[model samples]
Target: MNISVIGCGYVGTTTALMFCELGYQVVAVEKDSKKLAMLQQGKLPFHEPGIDSLLIKHLHRGSLVFTGDIEEGIAHSKIIYITVGTPSLPDGSSDLSFIEEVSRQIGAAQNDYKAVVIKSTVPLGTVDKVREWIGKAQKRPLPVDLVVNPEFLREGSALYDTMHPDRIVIGSDNPEAAETVKQLFHSMSCPIIVTDCNTAQLIKYTANAFLATKISFINEIGRVCDAYGANIEEVASGVGLDHRIGPHFLRAGIGWGGSCFPKDIAALINMGNNNGINLLIVQSAQQVNQDQIGYFIDRLEGELHGLNNKTVSIYGISFKPETDDIRESPALKVIAEVQRRGGTVAAYDPMVFDKHPELKLPGVRVARNMEDAWKGSDCFFLITEWDQFSKIDWGQVMQEMRTPLVLDGRNVLDARKLRSLGFRYYGIGRKTGIIHE
Candidate 1:
């Protein structure tokens, strides 16, 4: 089978490569010329582990190809996947202009039966809007089936998540169309859910909202633990052992941030508001996440006496490890807050700095290396927990810093070990008392 993926962003690129891995020829479409050139060369425009290698393999085998022309992509396959971005508008509603434009293009270029699959995360009832847009754009009457196949891939581990999804959801009013899409994933050993378009869209939003809630819930608990001198890790471990909780999204940290969670939660909240239903739990989750950043900064400020004239060494800039996606990243928020308090910022990331050498953060000193981030700094703040951070020489860090203050935002550092090195250590809900000194 041939598949056309429109848009070459992380989700689009990953989806195209996934189809190629499934033995289907894929033609990926991207309007951005730079991204198109990168894709043509088997180079990813963004940082994602394991995707680059798959892209190279597929291009070599003639299974995957890149194109900037939407008409060409639409004509290349009967199954057209709309994986374009539906970024959040200022009003918290999903801006579906991209989806709408793509739909119109597909419709305008359609000459035969086409199964249009929506792989992008969209608001509920968007499938209906897409159907309308596509119908109106067609030069004449043409058979087109719309399918809502929401993606559930994580950023850092996108390829693994795509190749090994927990479930496959095919949403369409037409059972035949749904079944046809379902057969495309017959080799994958996972439950395939066939449902209406609305339900599938809701499932995507609800899944991200619930995960955001879990993160906020645990972070709120972490605040309580901090006040009572309790161990949050132990608390989470005990709570997760109950099988009902299942130990995922239970890790408490600076809080959840990424492309999906914040936007989805906001859109879900906006959905509830438009329907006269106040989603209080989700609203609180959003609030708690925002406040968690302030709470961490407050601790840092109090420990330093004041941030004015202080230098803060930020260990990680990207939201999380193994990816360079900084959209809604908590680290950026932390950087902004630190600067607001008059602190000078020095930042380092294993991937972000190297991948985006031209990347500039206002008022941030980009460190050449991890050691450069902490040198002459007052506090070593670990925001994103890259694996390399876990193996850092804390003793050496203590010696190099003007003041040996360690704030482990992700709580991946050893509190005891840092304290033994004569550095003051603080982790969210972890023991702050000096263990060795």
Candidate 2:
């Protein structure tokens, strides 16, 4: 299959590389000169585990070609996948201006019959809008059946999710186009759900909304545990053992922060509002998630009396571990709030600040190492549960910090052992010795 993938961010880049790996001749299109130049030199614009080698392999194999020409990209392939950004607006609605602009470009560039795939997450009936744009721009109707193919990828494990997806969904009014897409995915043996375009779009939003609800549900429970002096980790473990509620994303954390969950949840809220339907549970979950950051800060301040003129060291920055993505990262929000309260902040992450080179937080210093982050700090904040954090020698951290204060926002650290090591430990919704006001 010859394919053109527009937009080369995390989702588009990973999908382009995967299709090329599957032996498709891929023409990757990007408007960013720097990113296009990097791709031409076999360099990825961002950090994705194992993507560098995959890009290099496909470039050497002559299966992947990166470019910025809309005509060349359109003329070279029959299947065009539109993958762009849909940022959230101030009132939690999706700002799909980027996707709309790309639709205009794609409509103008269409020369023949092609499969236009919607790989970017958009509001419902967006595929119809793409078709409408094609009609408006081309004047003479372009022969393109818009397919709603939403991506359900975890940030850290995107490649794995692409290869081992729970299901492959293709939504279109044209049955032939739907089956053609199914046949194109010949390498993957995942369950295929062929449906109409609206259902496909809704499926993606509903999935993310449910997962976000699960996370907020647990975090809200953590709030209750904090008030009653109960341990959340233990309660979650016993509850999750019932085989009904799975253990994934069930742990109480600062909040759910990434590109997908926040945007999609808000989009669904907007959808309900437009149709005059009230979603109380989803709305409450959003509220609970918003509160998590403030709750974590309160815990830290309670432990140390006051954050004014205090030195705090933060361990991780990325929203989750194993990937360098900072979109809607909780660490950024928490650090910002702490500094707003007159505290000095320092942070060290295994990855980040590369693609986002201008990530400057006022009154914050990026640390060089674990020792440098912990040196003489009054308290330590664990925002993301990176694997290396659990393996650290708490004794060394306890020995180096100005005060042996540890706030485990992710609940990844052992509270008992840290307490025995002469460190005051705090976990979200856990009954630690240090109580928040």
TM-score, prediction 1: 0.98
Cα error, candidate 1, residue 396 (Å): 1.2
- Which parts of model 1 are misplaced by more than 4 Å? 433-437
lDDT by residue (1-437, candidate 2, tens digit) is 79999889999988998788777899989989998999989997777787898889999998999899977888888888888889899987888787777778877877788888888998987887888876677746768878878898887788888878899888989999998887878888899899999899999999998999999999999988888888788888888888988787789988898888988999999999988989888898899999989988887887788899799898889989988888898898888888987789999887775556778877788887778898999998899898999899888888789999888879889887887788878887778634332
Model 1 residue-pair collision total: 0
RMSD of each: 1.1, 2.0
lDDT of each candidate versus the true structure: 0.92, 0.86
The positional error of residue 154 in candidate 1, measured at the CA in angstroms, is: 0.5
Model 1, 1-437: lDDT tens per residue?
Answer: 89999998999999999999999999999999988999899889899988989989999999999999999999998999999988889988989999999999999999899999999999888888999999999999999999999999999999999999999988999999999999999999999999999999889989999999999999999988888888999999999999989898899889988889999999999999999999999999999999999999999999999999999999888888999988889999999999999999999998887787677799999988999989999999999999999899877887899988888898888887788778888888886543344
Indicate which candidate wins on lDDT: 1
